[model samples]
Target: MGPRFQNNDRARLYREIYEQHGPIAPVVLPGDVPCWLVLGYRELHQITSDPVLFSRDSQLWNRWPEIPADWPLLPMVGKQPSILYTVGERHQRRAALISDALAAVDPFELRSHSERFADRLIDELCGRGSGDLISEYAKVLPALVLAQLYGFSDEAGARLVPSINALVDGGPDALAGRDTVKSAMSTLLASRRAAPAAGVASRLLYHDYARDFSFEEILEDMMVNIVAGHQPTADWIGNSLRLMLTDDRFAASLSGGRHSVAEAMNEVLWEDTPTQNIAGRWTTRDTQLAGRHIAAGDLLMLSFAAANGDPQVRPDRGSFTGGNSAFLSFGHGEHRCPYPAQDIAEGIARTGIEVLLDRLPDVDLAVSPQALVWRPSPFLRGLASLPVRFTPTPKSTAGGSR
Candidate 1:
């Protein structure tokens, strides 16, 4: 029997699945379709790295072509070549170039931008005394960061963030959000192509992969970076902050010098990563992995959340390190996330948390931790709204400027 992934009680659900399913186990998802969920840290590591046996090209997925129009799984599994769907040479070439483009980003500049944006946002909220951190701060801040990376105007971030959020929700909103993203990306990239800017998107358009990528291809890549980076970054920010507030030991670890902010971020990435599962890895042929039987064209998913929490993984950050380390929150091999490295992303989040803690000395959850609601989704783990109460303070003279 397969495990039902309960939205509200994810920790318990993941533990039960691991205890029962071993590392690689069979399960039927919400759509009544069967799939193998890779649960163990070592098991997922092997599968995610083995490209010959497990293909990412969704065209190999048997049920996708005729999936019901109303299927909830579409948002997570739908074909998008920008990063998640490509396999083999395509995946390798595209990922390398995107990585190179992101490598050019100045970490100091990114951190400064995040801090300035945080201060500006807090300036607007300090007088109010309370606000929904998820909507007001966490979500918008990441999108704005992404907007800067893509060289998008301030106006574009406002439009893209909500549309991207809606896009991930699936169904009718997904369609609208998809169009909104496509329109925004197309306009943004088209301008870059016409008169290139000194940024990630413009650099990508001139990279090696762009030789084979059409205008549509370039746009898809742009959309994936902005969409991928923002949501998970937002989730990371929210989840990490939640840990600081709810887990007294964790909070103590951060405040009492047991763990630095960087170490705390690593702990969150291992313990409660924003991305719970990455779907749509199809088996190339009948095979057995980690002593499990599989058939050709069988669907598989990597349970990063489950694996990081596996008994095998050490929870301690060990000297506050980051990088490709043992944590699979960023996935591994050919299909990893194509954005800034762990250190850069963490730098942005660090600045954000630092600003919030500095500006609002006593900010805290507005409700009990257990009462917090996680949105129902197959791929993402996010709080629906993070209502936070803070001491009222005078707004900065900076006003509401970006």
Candidate 2:
């Protein structure tokens, strides 16, 4: 099996593959799923920037006949019929609608809500003196922010995290998770259609594209947005917290030395990309990329993690200041994530992490950082848990006592 599916030391494995196999290396994931990992900075730029040769729609795959019906990678690579999976004019239309709905959210309110959610989480955990920072804190914060964006109450946000985790996890239980998410989303879609509340979902309903959507379409779109919105932000917060607790040089920057929260977030984005590998491209015909032969219909994923660590990428760059495009964490080309608004992933991630660190200044990993476990998913990267400890403090008044 390729190093992609291995739960431990994934960044080192990708670098090893790059040294052995050059820019574009072929690797087999679990279930014997075969695909190419684009491992170089230059190679990824070319593939992502050029869409005609690499179709985002897996429906264009000529190799599906060879793939197993129970293919475990469906949740990642299979066609989900959303803006995320489409290309050209079809992608533009739906992407615009999602962007418009996202823009409707007030940025000040979004920032305020994220800070409030982060502060509230600290309030619950600060008295404990110890907790699994992953499940108890970082992982749950973004879902709460997303809950507000979707027009659902903040309490309802916690309920959707499990389903999102299931959808991304390449385990046997994932299908059941997908089903639960579908059922819940369908109910949400129905409620929005009937009552029309004031949130992203309600805004989406009135859009020309969604106005004619069937129940299944509405469910699929909603599911895609929730996963797209929450997963990376959670991963960002989780990865950042792990680095702050484990790496001294990195942690120093966060503790009032060099980097701001935005700088630290960009550093993590460039160094240890949250969404490690994403497979959307299907080779339309035989083509050679960066000296490697890519056959028609072969699946291809951009190794965002590997590309960031590529020799050409400046390992020291900490901020997205100026015009630097050194990271491909959010991807490139027309298919770049549509919801770039403040109330979306990045805003929630920055606001939440900054508040948590300020309120819990003494937080440190309870377990050896090396002892932490990772979920065994080939397409994504995150810790299984981050056990941490700090001196218990009374409820924080500085965080507005939220």
Clash-forming residue pairs, model 2: none
Give each model's whole-structure lDDT.
Answer: 0.76, 0.75
lDDT of 2: 0.75
Report the Cα lDDT for residue 53, model 2.
Answer: 91
Tens digits of per-residue lDDT, candidate 1, 1-402, equal 122454545656777777787778898876677889888888788787888888887777876665787676766777765666877787777788788888888886787678777887788799999998888888888778778777887677767878887776564687888898889888878899899997788988998777877787778877777777778888888877787778664565333333445566776787678888888589889998878888888889888888877755644423333433467888887787644655566666777776777777778889998787777666777777888998899976633232
lDDT of 2 at 327: 76
Best candidate, TM-score-wise?
Answer: 1
How close to the true structure is residue 201 of candidate 1, measured as C-alpha lDDT? 81
After TM-score superposition, the amount by which residue 393's alpha carbon in candidate 1 deviates from its true location, in angstroms, is: 1.4
